[model samples]
Target: MRNVDIVQLSVFVLFLAAVTVVGFLAARWRRGQTLMHLDEWGLGGRGFGTFVTWFLLGGDLYTAYTFIAVPAAVFAGGAMGFWAVPYGAIAYPLVFLIGPRLWSVSHRHGYVTTADFVHGRFGSRALGLAVALTGILAMMPYIALQLVGVQAVLTVMGITGTGPAADLPLFLAFALLAAYTYTSGLRAPALISFVKDTLLYLVVIVAIVYIPARLGGWGNVFDSAEAALSKPDPATGRPSGSLVTNEMTHWAYGTLALGSSLALFIYPHTVTGALAAGRRDVVRRNAAMLPAYSVVLGLLALLGYMALADPGVVAAVREAGNPQLAVPFLFDAAFPAWFAGVAFAAIGVGALVPAAIMSIAASNLFTRNVYTAFLRPDATPEEETRVAQLVSLLVKAGALVFVFAFGRSLAINMQLLGGIWVVQTFPALALGVFTRWFHRWALLAGWAAGMVYGTWTAYLSSSPAQEHFASPLAEIPFLERNGYVALTAFVLNMLVVVALTVAFRAFGVPDGADETSPADYTADAADRLAAPEDPGRALTGEGPR
Candidate 1:
């Protein structure tokens, strides 16, 4: 492919600068006299209403990972990639049923992190700490996958498209993102998402409609793909892993979409996005509306299939020699160079929006759980904000290691593996939301069993083509009869919790104090303004806001 033009590069840079400005200005947009408080920093002053919550949750859930990886999967495989669309569509109803209650419980009890809620609900600090660590662990790699999304765009526009300085451009983007996020907290990402998602929708729509016409029609485009993929492997005289026959990868990707969507809200960042809403109704409305983004996701994933349909597009992307760059190359070859630049920028911005939010979410967990729990027991609101700011940078730095260490292909796989690891926390975070009677000790063992089982199952699987564990996205590890491991692990987690609860009752194992009641979980509208720490903490030595 030709080198990116100065005009195209300038357009990309211009949009990034616009986003940074938006992020910085958002500090004042949602004006709070004191940005010193954890409430203000971590949750965006908890004042975003229906309209902003639409953008905020839209930004948080449907990230660059959705834009880049989903397309790449569709491009690499086939219809299984479309699983993301249905998963997201179904997630809305799931959230609608559960989200309001989660918001109510979090608000009334002053829980900033899911760990805080678990600890309060079950009266088990060790269990809460485990949940918090799992959240941080799962989120960091997921964030790195977003950074890799930026790299995928850069590889097409710079490193592979141009030459050298490929690394520099992404570094520059991250430096600016980290600066703004550190300065503005969750507000930076929430504010920037409006621009990021708009550009993405526009670019995806144009690519889907325009590319079909340019190639053949939609029918011809798919027909060409079927022919291309059906061809002999040339050397091997066998098709290169037929989508229909590759049951392992297909089941894996499909199940991953289903399981990951379930795990999505369990992530602390997702909860942060939900709780940042000014009203519980805002969350309810967004849950119903957010699936609209899946239309764009389906189109983007189809871009991958479109790439496979046309060999000219494929050969051009091969110059860059990375699968994830397939989307940018397809756009560059099929569309005008200027639009390609805009699409690239859209993906780059898409990456930054979620990366910033994820870093904030993980850092918020660290500050609220670890620092406040064991370190500065008497830290003020201002000090808590400072701690979160520092931890946010460190979380990014940790994710940055994964981004460079594995680059795109492995980073994506790591994100899938990370999902399995993180999904292990779902039993504690999700089930505990509805009940406080699971017995804290049982929940702890369930979490431990899940973490062990999910990791071991993922580790045991490998692909001859990829020469690695192919991840949960590619290989759905099942039992003797076959079933999803993440889902399986979750059942085991629940079974352990239930069995232990029964046994503990027989033996009279003391269930810890239940801090949250049913009424507490179903908080009223007036409960939204409660502080992020429990007032009961003042009675204990847990300090005050």
Candidate 2:
């Protein structure tokens, strides 16, 4: 706390203020007929073009947590941390395949949330409600993880302490976030994302290029990391770092990558970004182009090695007792104060973009799925938008409470658990976009089974540092090998869905009607945007307003 640089703090504060102004002013960008409709407030009038979608989705996917935590994972566990690279690569291909279909169907039907699509596709409000609840629950921990990223930067900048003081800056940041997101909805994050992504590219490029030159070289950095990681830790009695995975961890790495990839776009925030695009092609083009961030992520992972090579970063991280601070501390130590502040501001804005989107996504889920589906079936557009705004603020406040109560490590744990829970929604949401053969009841049953199993399994798992929900990986069922618990649960979910679909069909149990047509899945941007809206109502029968 004593080493705070006044110049750096000023720079950081300056950039933050600039972004806050951007957020508040975004409400007027592409101003709609009014901001009362879910289409306007929740999904930015569903009008963002290719370039905007590119930056927005990039900012949403490559979060501050990705910047801070991937390197931190590498710092602590070596080769395992680099699973993010493969995960990012795996994800974009899936995104290219699924994203446009989701956007088209959603745009055609005026679907503001994934659950809205599920409900319409399955003709079952209960299934939609289930998906909505799962999304909100999964998103909270994810939002909390972003706040943890912000807190890490604040901690490194000597702005953190105990009690009320420790959380004051975090609360202030989130308060400002909630304010603009409430006023502008998805528009706020969408506009600020350009700034966030630009700064991120600058900071990441500079850090990767300059820091290694200052340290020694990439060769020495890797050598130092490998050497440091090879030493046995007294707590686990295992070596941490390697250039590649060994026999014991291969399954874990592969499954983690695969599972995380499957879970990535299914998240509400991710889907929100995609669905907010003006055109279906925007989704596809961005999917192809967004892999540029994967390249950045791969380079970013090497920061762990650079941090390992720097004795100052290593010692500081040890004293802080939080590996999440590794990147922030590294930046502070290695860069000039002004440059370091720029980097810190990049990380802070990184957190803000996703946090705003996640809260908005969760709010959409609540307003459409819970409030409209159950509580106020005839709520007007203005009421729906108002409710969503309030919930968005509440969601952000909940995430703040989550970080304060559980601390950073548990926030990480909860995010892993959230990933496990979110992947369960795939069979219902993603598959439904391609096929309606899945029985609605069967899908519901599978979701329930997966949620219960995944949560219980994750809760039982423990790591050296924590007692519950410590890791996303668990022993493969009856295989005596470790793999991502989420993937395992996903398989179980699919099996149950298949078996039940068969049994239900055999018994002649009625499958619900699907409201969507085949051509609806292929709806183009011109058709969707040209469709007329009925004020205070959704596009189709009893859908979300």
Candidate 3:
């Protein structure tokens, strides 16, 4: 057993309790007629302005796993881990272009989930179901990684116990998360994000500035990290990593950044955040402004190097045999007890915000696409909202299961695996936003091929620590150079989609009816008055007017 820090635990608990109260109060913050509708519960009544949308999307995308895992990756792998910084930078431009279009269409048509948009656009429930299931599958590990973030902080605070009881603190924290998420729906996270983001920014800014000062400045920190990383690893008989990427590793680094950027906004949670905006301009403005978080991400990644500069932190991490502890341990050792407690609370609350949003997003997909479409086509809006609320709880429970089952391995890899599955939906959801020229059946077939190839390639990837799902990089077929497996699989997915589209057209196969029009993609909130409730009318050439 480890000695728990009483002052730190008390401060952490106080901040957590404060947020728990705020979360429950959010249900009445902006009251709708009732919380019995998906518009209010699943999408926060679709009325968030620029201020709220910025925080919500920032809190959602820059998650606790980001706080813990990115730094941990930097601590373990050196320069390659900085891929997260560039990928984050690249994602926002893509979001700026795609976000407004998706928000406009989703706003006009009352789409609560990406799957709903897919079903309407392609006029193929089968394709919609594929997207829905893939989203749910991808989210499991991602949500679990958030809990792993909390666990790492707890472990650093010496709150751990033996065996099954060790996880009690994690479950208890998530239980609080589930309660408010069920009660307030999207509003819980939207309101709580203010607190989460504020604390996170305060903690990160202080840590970056103060820690570097304490460690003899940034230059010394980098020199120490470089010396540490340049040492040969006994397991691989190679240098752990370097301060810069060389030719041999450049392709892997570039592809990882590019593939991650493509996958970022395609996540159901990000889509949920974008669609919740009050206007199309909210999405665009937030996308243009959200790069501010990327600066914080770069600062956070530098903490890994700072930790390497501190011999105490390095020794503690070596003893724990877990790199995820680097950031938490760094803060704990480098700061006073009260400030360290505040930092811990920041990470913990950071987990709650995104975990709540992700579960809500996943539940929205299930309730709209899976439950209503297949289980109860005639289900009322009230029934749909109720089902979504319950599934949100189940999604949290499933993530808990994932945490226990997977143990506390590398949290970043788990997120990358989720990204691999989520990116497959891009052709259908992201591409479909601008065009329906590709046959719906071909999109379905391509999704299947990408899923199979990505999963198999990830399975074959082995590292010194694990056998399967060991790394996100695999050798690109024919290229013989290692790169992100997701991108390779995505290329295969697109090729299949293109080839099948041509053949199906040549054979005169019937393309599914398109339910969306060009105007729909560009429509603003002002156009909502004329938007169609019945998308099927477009199938009969009676388009929404």
Winner on TM-score between 1 and 3 is: 3
* All models, RMSD in angstroms: 2.9, 1.9, 2.2
> What's the best-to-worst order under lDDT?
3, 2, 1
lDDT of 2 by residue, 60-169 (tens): 88887678888888898888888888998898899999999988888877788899889988989889999999999888888888888888887888886778888787
lDDT of 3 by residue, 1-545 (tens): 56999999999999999999999999998868888788888889889999999999988999887789999988988999999999978889989888899988777777788988898898898999999999998888899999999888888888888887789877887799889999999999999999999998999889978999999998999999999998888788899888898888899999999999999999999999999899998998998999999999998998889988999999999888889999999999999999999999999999999999999999999998899888877676788889999999999888888787664657898889999999999999888888888999999999999999999999888877777788889988897889998999999999999999999999999877766678888998877622333322222234363
Q: What is the lDDT of residue 4 in candidate 1?
A: 53
Candidate 3, backbone clash total: 0
TM-score for candidate 2, residues paired by index: 0.97
TM-score of each: 0.92, 0.97, 0.97
Residue 514 lDDT in candidate 3: 68
Clashing residue pairs for model 1: 75-304
Looking at model 3, residue 257 earns an lDDT score of 97
